[model samples]
Target: MIDVYLLSGFLGSGKTSLLSHIIEQFKKEGTKPAVIMNELGKLPFDSRAVEADVPLKEMLEGCICCTGSEKMEAQLQMLLEGESFDVLLIETTGAAHPVEAMDAVYSPLFASKLNMKGIITVADCKRWLDRDKMTPQTRMLFLEQIRHAHLIVANKIDLLTDSEIATVTMQLQALNAKAPIIQTSNSKLPLNIMKKIEATFHEKEINETAIGKQLFLSSRLHTFQEPVNQEDFECWLKELPDTVYRMKGYVPLVGHKNPLLFQYAYGMVQWLPEMIKMPPQIVIIGDQVDRIDVLGRISND
Candidate 1:
């Protein structure tokens, strides 16, 4: 399976810069890379960073997550049918939500053909520190982008004062307790970022087995055999830990004839009405979650 990496960050947070660096590194290691870049404008700019030799597919006019899932799936199919590459990189628009972008990539049609490496979020240190100046929606988006990352690149540290750096680092750590953060300037990264990330994951795997902790970025699927009380489910959601980054599936709520499509990210929960019958299961993604305990609580409810 081809390894897939999703690049996420707010506008001017150095996502394109990081994408360029990653592609260059892959080229040095004799690995061919393909890119699927999303832009929220009519014209594409980040597409220039992708080299001519690298197979490229651009999604312009909207964020991939906001765009129809069918479009995203079709683009992936086209790339797979036409290109040969060791790795695929998706650069999302600044306005995109990391969890939603991931949902788009998890299309069942191409799921078996790819191995999800993880989301690598590039955050501008100064921008992160001043995120409150942004509109409420934008600020929430910024936080969510950082919160759901598998690996974070705290970029543009050159512009931040020493004290500001500490403040931002502390906040980033608080938001994402497990993802490794690499401080950089100009979106520059260490030559072994991938190796370091892999090593970190391996260590987490060992720790998981030794201490009975959930694996970092691990996912669990739970299928409900019967409909659950809506009030009970909402209460359970409120009690979920912040480590539960994302969850999505169909849920059969009491009093409803059909299961509702549910999506949760960060602290927000969305339940969309579904007309057709769907599987009653949820895919929970998080770090160090107590799977047995979590399932038990929901099952008892």
Candidate 2:
């Protein structure tokens, strides 16, 4: 049976970073792995950043736990039949609830063909602590992502002091007393930990009420024709409306020769230089955001 690992976490929790590391290790061991990236936005960002040689299938425009499950299953079927891989990794969107994602895995079609090695949940130390500041639905979604994991990876520990680290460890323990907690910065962890055999599914522990609630969230994608002034765009990103939860895409800057990749989560914003030439486009995921207003603001000179 193929070993399948489900990597679940909140937005910006370093899931992709961790996945890259896992893929590199697999390469060293002469094992080929397949990746299934579940993205909440229509335009892919995290998948593009991942450096892997294996075949990658993207489930975009919706979370795999809900509307995208059928597509995900079809992709998995194709991978299993057409390719030879030692392991399969499913990287879920930050907003995905573990219970629902697992349900897709336990479906009749896939349950017999693959063995779930473990459910690894990556938790951003800072964001996990401040989750209460978000809306009720988002806060619950964050908690539910951790509740069912066999391993809870408390990432971004480098950002915390020793005292802060201890406090965060205690908080994670309170939230998930059963799962083993591993702390790391930049989502780094020992390869042996992932290879260890562990119990994969916990159907009895799933909270049925939380399974279908995330579908209420809204998402919109917008494209811009002109390059934006770097300073002006940064200022606007900093003051984005509270309704916007996650924003990411590629943008061309006024003076820079190459376009830049941008990602914004809550109050944090990051811009990285890119070599590829792609049209200026962005995907915004939030609740009740006005599409026309967002387009006007982004298109402003």
The candidate that wins on TM-score is 2
**Candidate 1 backbone collisions, by pair:** none
Per-residue accuracy of model 1 over 30-146 as CA lDDT, tens digit each: 999999998654445457678899999888666676554677788899999998989999998766777678678887788789888888889888777766665454566778788
TM-score of 2: 0.91
C-alpha lDDT values of all predictions: 0.74, 0.78
Shift in Å, residue 133, candidate 2 = 0.8
User: Would you estimate the TM-scores of all the predictions?
Assistant: 0.65, 0.91
Question: For model 2, where is the 10-residue window of minimal lDDT?
Answer: 207-216
Runs off by more than 4 Å, candidate 2: 208-216, 295-301
lDDT of 2: 0.78
> Which pairs of residues collide in model 2?
none
Q: What lDDT score goes with residue 167 in model 1? A: 94
Kindly report which residue stretches of model 1 are placed more than 4 angstroms away from their true locations once superposed. 195-301
* Prediction 1 global C-alpha lDDT: 0.74
